[model samples]
Target chain A: MPNILVVEDSPTMRQLIGFAMKRIASSRVIEATDGIDALKKLSSEKIDLILADINMPVMDGLKLVSLVRSNPAYKDIPIIIITTEGAEEDKKRALAIGANAYLPKPIQTQELIKLVNSFISQ
Target chain B: MERETSIGKKADEFLQLFRKGEEFTHEILKENERLRFKLAQLEEAIERSGDEAKIRLYEERIKFTEDELNSLKERFRQVEEENKDFAAKYVEVEDENNNLANLYVASYQLHSTLDFNEVLRIVLEIVINLIGAEKFSVLLIEEKTNELIPVGAEGISISDVPKVRFGEGIIGTAAKEGESYFSENIHNLHNRGSISTETPIVCIPLKIKEHVIGVIAIYSLLLQKEKFSNVDYELFNLLAGHAATAIFSSRLYTQSERKLTTIQSFLDMLKEKPRR
Candidate 1:
């Protein structure tokens, strides 16, 4: 089963995203509170895909994306930015930094499921 | 006759001797007068040289005093400049210290509680007391409705406020955009009709990670405040992250605590029941 990492600070949001990921695919869902935590997890376990939020405390999503993209080992892994920063510039910047997709918050469960499914299947 | 002639010759010789002696005495007196005149001239010259030496010494002393005075004046100017520099530096340091203290207190009060209502109250208090915001409101976004609802308010009646949907008004737009909105003159903005024109407005989004959980609407500033300063913006940014995170964390903690208590009660009930 593919191991998916969900990086979000809020516990409620993390639970919501975890639930959606489980319903869509029978994959291993790992939760991380922030980008720093996510990086620690990535080092220990194999993460196939990453879903990240933008404005976390220790390290934000953009910094995480840049770090991941710069690494030789994890550069090819797909990253999806799911954040409340829904501005056009935010989306453009995320895509420019090597994110595979940008999804705004208050996201529909089906859309998230479909997005996660598409990436894992590929 | 011969004897008379010899006596006359002797007298003539003696008269010649007396004439030579008189000539020698006149020459000696002339030489003595010349020596006295030369001694007087030498004494006058020595007195004049002594007066000249005294004048030269006084001139040197005057020059030295003037130089010392000028040096002292230069030292005074340097000291004055240093004092001005130190005063300016002290003010800057004091301002920086005050800002740091404000941030420290704000962080402390924000994290001091885990109760949702207490968090809202503390945030409001910080905005009012620390930030010097006179009129403001704290609005949380209803996740289901995606609407901004006022939870706490000051200097304005709660009834006077209108319902704002997400991305609708200034407060809603700030929450929707997940960015801060500061207007020195609210009358110039698109949503002036919704806000009071008595003072400027600043809308800050309270965000946890990327999600904007709430918005802080500042309608007016204190009388002492003329405009928003960089420090005010810093405080706004602090509120955006720290305040939001505090509220979100507290809510989650309370919810989890309740769930744990419920689970513990369930276990207790099951243990009391007959073994199955």
Candidate 2:
């Protein structure tokens, strides 16, 4: 079972994703309110994967992704940027920053589950 | 930035050096005295009220400068408070969203029992509780009157909303234009004597398609003036859509029930045996 880290500024979004993931995945879900906090958790915890939201205060998810990819300890951990921003440029940037996947907000649960499974399988 | 700091330091050093130089310092003192003598000579005319217009002009200039200084001070205060409030909102939205308020709204929207008034009350609750507005109201659009009539309200006397109309007040203009407005400082603004305090008013237009449906108005006691976020717009629009759908559905339900009764009574009459 993969331990998933969920980073989002919105509680509703966190719950929506957490609930959906709980229903679908055999993983221990952890939460972080913002990118800085997310960074701390990624370092201290053994996180297998991540689901992060963009447009957060204190440090944004894009910066967080770059940070995570740069860190030697957490570099290989698959981070999927799950955000409301659905622009292609944002998607490309996320991937370019070493994000494993990108899912837009109000994420369809089934699709999210499929993506998670594919990531875990790989 | 460093150059600006260096310039300030150099100016302080220059003043110190000027004070150290006795000869140059005496010369500067004489120059100041000469300027003061000239200023006093010119000041005699206005001081004696030789020309009332000139005196009035000086008074007005003094008042204008004072007012400008006060305004700048207020602007500084507003900006500082605004930044603090922004930080607070960031904290709040993070914390409140943790409570699943969005899901609550979503589920609430799905419930058919909430009439327009009830829905508005709920919306008002969101505004007051979550958004931190001191006063909030949802005024429904009356097509007949072309006015936004108050449906649900908070932090206002009923006497305040005495038959408000379009083109009548600030709210009216906002509602009429179907545009959101945020007056950070409302001292110079008019509101038909409805709003008493010289506070900021944030008016959000509620519309569905081309028809303006309502207005969500809130008054800010804080320096925060951001009236509506994307989430707010989305939720307000969703709530409006919910209101419209629920209204149509309920009306249809009532019509069906009436028809069902009529059909039942007609069948009852048809079942009766005919007399020869």
Candidate 3:
């Protein structure tokens, strides 16, 4: 029943994340090309969670997180930042700006599903 | 007077006999009371013995119940342990399944496009997303020059990458020999961004059958990738075959298209000329 929004620039990465998200029982995966496309999808659907990559074209994930946090209607939704940035500063910044969790790639799909499920089941 | 003395003595005798009878009756009553007391003590002892037997029976039942409860508790613990092991195994299997899915997706996308540039882009994406390569390039062997030229690159500029002749260096030799090279010191590198033209961490030669077409050289992996995994080796094998075919076929298709266009233009020019 949870709707997960996946925002990534690479089509292959997007497909990879989407494939993992679909394994969650009764969960619907909404794909977006980048942060801008994520925002567009956000307006149309009631997104339960957001899995976004920090490095993306058009708009990055941090900007998306900031935008989502500022908005009253979408503020409560959980956001998981998936990125290749393994630096502590990047992780701390993402959390400080309102990302619920940070996951670095190369992504373990099992871990990804478990983390999402935890947030959804909460 | 003699007769009166005789009667008084007889009376005295009768009184003495009555007193002796009264003493006998008192002794008998005392003996009966003592016997009753002994009987009461014996009955109480018997009752006490019966209560002890019941207590012993209840104690045995309680001991049995306690043992049964402990057995059940142990069984529950075992079941819980088994469930935990199953959960761990399930996670492992799921991870394996996801790895397979990555392979499937990478292979599917590689062959999905016939555009030469698109094919190169897919290869780069697979290397980045699946293989976790950070600094890498797809170099095709230039037929005329017999050199490997960078067709696609990430993390380093394509112009900066050096071209080497076939069978020259590690990468070139990999292409020439149609073999994959994985550096033993891949995990020992301190600076991941430093470009080493001669020493790439991995070089997978792309081949169509026995003909080596190109090579995918990976200089550095992502910061989080400590080493290559089994699935990564499988991906390399897959890329060696499928990516090579895709790239080769797409290049051939593009070349043939250009040749067809040029030939059509020449035919049009010939038709346009007026007969003398």
Candidate 4:
């Protein structure tokens, strides 16, 4: 089973994402409240993929993506940004920052599952 | 004795001639029988060859018929595909025509009367019925304060509507810059403290000659529409100019009408005083 990391500020959002992921495939999910917590988990655990929210308290998703991209060890890991910011500029910035994919809020459960499965299998 | 010997020789010659004639007759009979058998064999062969030719002809005809049938089927299939294509194109063209018609009707209705409330009603109708927006609000800019005041709204309680200052929120920013702001996700506005109820999918500034007079906030689309189409954007552009003009003209007409009524009443009062 692959280990997945979910970084979000909201507990409900984290649970929703976790439920969607677990329903799609049997995998280990490590939850983090924000980017700072995510980094802490990353150092100790071998994470296969990351699903992160854009807005957070300590560090935002964009900053996390930039930091992850700069790190040589975790540079190649796939990062999917899920946020309520569906503007064209937001999408462009996320993709430019090395995020693998961007999913808008009011997330389609099946599409999210499919996207996760594709990334994990890859 | 000489005479007897001569007579015997003539008798022997006659008997030999008779035997030769009999042998010739038998040979002719045998030859005739052989020719009849060969003729029968040739006739049977000819008949069999004729039957084979007929069979070959029938086989060719069957093959030809099958090929013709297949060709016809292919033609039918192609025609059906063409018809389907034509039908799809027709529907597409019809949809385009309907959109254009709607724009025309909306333009006409906006300019139909100089009543400000009527103009707002018509705009709301176009937004709801034609554009398929479920929730929307029309806010006019107060010239003195440079704040947006909601004149009309749907899917929002009047008590809950918040006044937006110019250059503050998305609506205010749109009005301040005289630019339209369309957000596919409403959370961006929520982040800035503009909208509290539902997310607005579109925010358009009603402009007349680079001057934004008002703003239209579309909160959400109908369930059927996942996103705004190009046509919706076109409609937005149209509303930006035409809606502003309509509202401006109606306000002017109303003000002028009010002034005229006041003057007429004053004249009537003076005339009555003189008659008394």
Candidate 5:
């Protein structure tokens, strides 16, 4: 099973995303309410993909991406960012910081799954 | 009359016989009571056996019906499972197709807009996705200086675009050759001391009228060092040509607008002339 780590601050969104992923990809899903929690989970378990929100307390998604890329061990793992930042500069920054894929929110469920699939396909 | 006389005589004989039959009537009554008691006993036996028979028959029917219901429920579950699997696969395939459509839409954005900046941006992005290149750039030739100007760039980091040259830089060499060139080492290709960093890259010329008008360079990350293939060369060449044509149209529009404004001003100046 490909392990997916979902890092979001909202509980409702967490459950909804988890439910959607579960029905399609029968893999273990680990949820973290904040980036700090996500980082801890990343340390303990092997994660194949990450679906992260941009704005989160404790540690934001951008910072998490930088941290992940900076680590040699985690750099190869594909991270798909889910965010409200639609600006080109933001996209540039995200890609520069080692985000493999990006999706803007109020994300269509189909679009989100496609982006997810692209990363996990490798 | 004779027949009626015979019937009346028989009736008188029967009445006389009935009057003498009282002793026989008492004996018949005793036998009828004994037979009535035996009939009631037989009816009780049937009532007890009939209930057992009816219950056994119903229980057998119920067992058969319950077996059928269970089979139906099992079939329904199997159908439901198959339906769920198909629906999930449909959703997955549908999402993939929509992205394919979206990609086409994004690609079509290049052919629609004549805006130079947006066109360059769209084409480079499409090519980037198409070729799976780590980075890409589009440099339009400045008409006056003949210097390649980086109008649109993505997937690479080499700024100082507005004041860049064409003859001596990697782009300049491609322009001088008037042919698409690929160099794995950009630092080896560029000796101008202009670009300080050493990175592996590919440089291609965007040609028009058999004259090199612009240059394109794609760079991979420091890790990936695969050189550009013939396919990348051709794809980028086509994209760059379309982009250059769009640029020419936009530049033409701007020039004509300037001329129109100048003519209008000249006509206004004539209106201010005094009649002799």
Candidate 6:
């Protein structure tokens, strides 16, 4: 059972992502309003994977990815960036900064689940 | 003496005859031996031919089995490919199911509240999350002025949004005509940095039993949403019906509450009057 941390600022978007994550068998979803809340959750819970939105209010997804990569204790955790549809620069930067993969919005739930499952099973 | 010579010649002739008969019998025995050797060689050749026939039969059987095995392998490959195709199709159906579920939830949440502000918030949420609209406004028709005014919005301030008179522009026309309008060239109308109300991609009229109350104007979609999807259309239909009812109900409830408060205050003032 992998614990997935979803970091997004919009309440409805966060809820939608959380709803999609629930379909994954034996997976637990942890919600955070922004990157700062995500770090807080990371310090407390044994997070197996992270799904974060690129644009957020406090400390965006890229900053969180860089921070997680630089840290020794949580450096190995997989991060999947949830990018806007045509934001190629954000996708490239997220991957370059040690993000495992990306899922664009209007996200396909099956695709998101498959990507997570792959990372979790790794 | 002639009789003795003739008898001696006769004896010599008989001796020659006996020697010739012995030579004839030796020739016959040599011919019999040659025939026996030829018979043995023919029997050996027949045995070798029988063995070659059996070997040829076994080779044919092996070849047939090999063909069957290859055929089975080909069938297995096809079945595997078919299984892959089915798996992909199943995922597609599942994705579609999830999208429908989102629409259900959006509809459910809209009607779950009686607060006007809460209803507006739900509308905004549905547009952002389900419709993927980045900039939009909920404009209700003002009763006295006959103009559509922005009551709630996202990605644009309420003050920034201009009021549209009845049947004036795209939004006004949509509201006045009580019909939804979707832009044909939405792909080319994407603005990168700033938000604009000049060109709206979609305008859905909120109606209650053919009475148009307001309009949901979508100026631009999120950067990722290059085109509208089937599910988005479903969501718009849902919003047109459910959102309108929710907003109308909540506004009525608030108005009723205010009226009750006013009536209660009037009674209190009468009671506090100097025993008149």
TM-score, every prediction = 0.58, 0.38, 0.87, 0.59, 0.39, 0.82
Which number leads on TM-score? 3
B1-276: candidate 1 lDDT, tens digit per residue = 899999999888888878777777777777778878888888999999999999999999999999999999999999999999999998687566556655666777788889988888778767765565667888888889878888888667766665579997777788899999888564433332355622327889999889999888888654434455566777788999999999889889999999999999999998896977
Docking class of 2: incorrect
- lDDT minimum window of 10 residues, candidate 3 chain B: B186-195
Could you give candidate 5's per-residue lDDT for residues A20-116 as a string of tens digits?
5764576788999888899899999999999888878899999999998888988898988876555578878898888988776434556677677
Stretch of 10 with least lDDT, candidate 1 chain B: B191-200
lDDT of 3 at A37: 97
Candidate 5 — which pairs collide? B166-B172
Q: B186-221 in candidate 2: lDDT tens per residue?
A: 453334335542232767666655456767676542
Models sorted by TM-score, best on top: 3, 6, 4, 1, 5, 2
Query: Model 6: per-residue lDDT, tens digit, B114-161?
Result: 999988998997887678787899999998999998999988888989
lDDT of 5 at A9: 77
lDDT by candidate, in order shown: 0.79, 0.68, 0.91, 0.81, 0.68, 0.87
Worst 10 residues of 4 chain B by lDDT: B186-195
lDDT of 3 by residue, B1-276 (tens): 999999999999999898888888888989999999999999999999999999999999999999999999999999999999999999789878988999988989999989999999999989988888888888999999999998889988898788989999999999999999998886663346477967888999998898999999988887778888888999999999999999999999999999999999999999896978
Candidates in order, interface RMSD in Å:
17.4, 11.8, 1.1, 15.8, 12.7, 2.4
Q: Best DockQ goes to which candidate? A: 3
Which ten-residue region of model 2 chain B has the weakest summed lDDT? B220-229
Off by over 4 Å in 3: B1-20, B143-145, B208-211, B259-276
The candidate with the higher DockQ, 1 or 6, is 6
Ranking by lDDT: 3, 6, 4, 1, 2, 5
lDDT: the better of candidates 4 and 5: 4
